[model samples]
Target: MILSLIVAHTRNFTIGRDGGMPWHLPADLAHFKKTTMGSPVLMGRKTYESIGRPLPGRLNIVITGSPKPSDNATLRYVKTAEEAVKAAEEAGAKELFVIGGGSIYRQFIDRADRLYITLIDADIEGDTTFPEYDVRDYGIIASEHFSANEKNAYDMDFITYEKIKK
Candidate 1:
């Protein structure tokens, strides 16, 4: 399966603070939903807890040390990132999106086949950040710029990168 990561970060690569985002961008949320609509999204436990519910249109595989009682059909708990990938594969996923909260991103970034990044233009203060990675290993396949508006909190650029195959 294609392993992809979808994230929104600032210039300093800050992704979260106080267990939530520093800003709210409806357009970004819409973009996220559209991009991952039919794909299974894998996330760390904190990421799942922050959202507090399963995303309606796709399988939500959460990686954690402890399992929770789950009655939600779309939600599944896995002990490790490897198990998360296996769950997605077992569910017949062609693509698995590693949506995050710091540590989770660090674990699978080296294996990522693709990245969907939204660069928010602003000074964001956060405790969580995206791990540093060499951009030269991936080529930008797509990019879109959106100016600040009523729906979007800040000027942002949506960039899609695919790993440069050897």
Candidate 2:
């Protein structure tokens, strides 16, 4: 199975503040929905709660030490990152997206096969951050630049990086 990490972060790598994203970027949200629509998304319990509900059109796999009951058909629970991956694969996911809160990203960064990153051009304050990794390990496959619009607060670049074949 192919595993991918999809995230949007500021130049400082800030991902969240006070359990939610600090900026408003409708285009980024749309890109996220389009990219992970039919796939399985693996996220930490905190990330899941931040969303407050199951995301429609995708399998929502939440990793937590304490399992929570969910009547939502789209929701599932796992205790570890490996379990999350195995569950997604067993569910016939060819590609799994690791959508985050910092610790989850840190846990899967080394194992990710692809990265879909939106590089925001503004510095924002945040208590949560994206994990730092060596860019040398991946090669850029595609990138598109977007200017700030009414809905998107900052100029950003949507970049796709594939793991470099050794």
Candidate 3:
């Protein structure tokens, strides 16, 4: 299965503040929903809690060191990234989207085959940030720039990158 990392980060790589995102971008949210609607999405436990519920129409896999019973049928809790990937494979996923809250992003960056990144056009303060990776390793497959509007807090670019084959 293809492992894809999907994230929306500030220019400085800031992804979260406290337990939630520091900015609100409805357009980005819509973009995310459209992109991963049918795919299985894996996120860290904290990321799952921040959203407060399982995202409908998709399998939600939460990676936590402490596994617990998930009341939602669409939600599954796993202890490690390996289990998360295995869960996706078991579900017959063609691609797994790694949706995150910092730590989870770090665990799978090197293994990621594709990156769906939303680059917020402003610098924002946050306690958690995305890991640094060599962009040269991935070639851009698509990109579109969106100017900030009433609905979106900042200008952004939706970019998709696929890892360069060796």
CA lDDT scores, all candidates in order? 0.93, 0.92, 0.93
> Can you write out model 3's per-residue Cα lDDT over 1-166, one digit (the tens) per residue?
8899999998999999999999889989999999999999999988998999999999999998899887888999999888899999999999999999799999999989999999999899999999987889999999999999888869999999999989
Count clashes in each candidate, considering only residues at least 3 apart in sequence or on different chains: 0, 0, 0
After superposing candidate 3 on the true structure, give the runs of residues whose Cα lies further than 4 Å from its correct spot.
none
Lowest lDDT 10-mer window, candidate 3?
64-73
User: How much is 33 displaced in model 1, in angstroms?
Assistant: 0.4
TM-score of each: 0.96, 0.96, 0.97
Could you list the CA RMSD of all candidates, in the order they appear? 1.0, 1.0, 0.9
Q: In TM-score terms, which candidate is top?
A: 3
Per-residue alpha-carbon lDDT of model 1 for 114-144, expressed as tens digits? 9999999987989999987778999999999
Once model 1 is optimally superposed onto the true structure by TM-score, how far is the C-alpha of residue 64 displaced, in angstroms?
Answer: 0.7
| Model 3: how far residue 30 lies from native, Å | 0.4
Local error of candidate 2 at residue 54 (angstroms): 0.7
Q: After superposition, which runs of candidate 1 have C-alpha atoms over 4 Å from their true positions?
A: none
Residue pairs of candidate 1 with colliding backbone atoms: none
Candidate 1 is scored at a TM of 0.96
